[model samples]
Target: MLDRLDKEFAFGREALDVRAYRQELLSSNIANADTPGYKARDVEFSSALAGALKQNGTASNSSTLKMAQPVSLSTSSSLAVTSQGHMSGTSTLAASGGSTDDYGKLAYRVPSQPSLDGNTVDLDAERVQFADNALHFEAGMTVLSSQIKSMLSAITSNS
Candidate 1:
């Protein structure tokens, strides 16, 4: 059924989303390379993907895969309430953006060499990471395409 297709394609879809998010982070790092005190940031891809899938119950139970809601790393919430006090007043919300529970959360990168300006971005490293992520994103697309073709072929031949 279509539900099965959803489950089957979920991994590829999720991987693609994560890859795109990583690309964005890397691009930001590259763009801010010259900004004083701007720390380079990146997600731990595999762990982030795993965490996202787990949140959706996709990674743990194939039986529940069809019911699982999709989770995207790139579009995750950056702002959240710090306490009930924030929710008490309608005028303004006291929120925090430093949650460790964030899916595909960005982590500060360690520079190979320290800079006097306190910037942690290494242009060479960010560029290399960006290139690698772009390659993986394309590769994920290819795999997804293959899966779709196989599914379509099966359906057409059956009909």
Candidate 2:
């Protein structure tokens, strides 16, 4: 059934979503690299993925999930506003892995050197991270495609 397929491929689906979120975050950092007071942000992908699995009780490896860094902030709590007049447009990092709002947990990257503008984005680091993530994302896609193909082949053979 569809549920069986979901159980088999949920991790892949979640991973792809996570990777896309990361790509957006990295792209944002790169876009703001030249802007003043922009802080480079990245997420703990492994941890976020683990948290999600734990939430669903479908995690194959609980020990590895524990190794993932804790998501310190919850989007719901941060979104709570005291009054209608209060300004609350700050894009907060959602605790990745469990919630629907998992836009890669926004942790500020420490700057290699202090900038006069207080911008923390390091172009070189962002570039490397972006490329690495993209490559990994592609790898995940390849594996998922193979799995789907094999499943379809088995179905056709049985029929």
Candidate 3:
């Protein structure tokens, strides 16, 4: 019975998680619209949801939805910086202040209209996406609520 409940809620739960994360990304893009050289980032929603669901199904403790793990270079054959001007391969990741898990899944958005300052965020598009994702998140929550209500009613009626 517990397993049955888990299976029933898994899809909606995973979807909501993805939608919530996407909302955060869109909000960040909107917030950074004025920052020069700021590239807007987003996930491919359908694919991300699919991957999350797949991982959830295979792993027993897969309650959390996560992106792909970031790749790292082995120290054995890593690049050497002989000159002081050289930057390490991992420096960009560190400078971005984002974990490899997050950076791996996020893709830069191409600007519809190029900005003079090189920021890729389009406010109009970000707003549209944010609204759409919020709607989907609400829908998922409503469906989950309905499911739980129905289960509760069934359990009470039997008692």
TM-score of each: 0.74, 0.72, 0.70
Scored by lDDT, the top model is: 2
Runs of candidate 1 exceeding 4 Å displacement: 62-102
The whole-model lDDT of each prediction reads 0.74, 0.75, 0.74
lDDT of 1 by residue, 19-107 (tens): 77778779989999889999999998899778767766678755433332344234333545798766433343221211224355679
Given candidate 1, what's the lDDT at residue 131?
Answer: 92
Clashes by residue pair, model 1: none
In candidate 3 the C-alpha lDDT for residue 10 amounts to: 65
Cα RMSD for candidates in order: 8.3, 7.4, 8.7
- Give one digit per residue, the lDDT tens place, for model 3 in 1-159: 665677677677667777877888999999999999999999988877766666555235445333323444343334678899987653322212113242237789989999999999999999999999999999999999999999899989956
Q: For model 2, what is the error of residue 137's alpha carbon versus the real structure, in angstroms, after optimal superposition?
A: 0.2
lDDT-better candidate, 1 vs 2: 2
* TM-score between candidate 3 and the true structure: 0.70
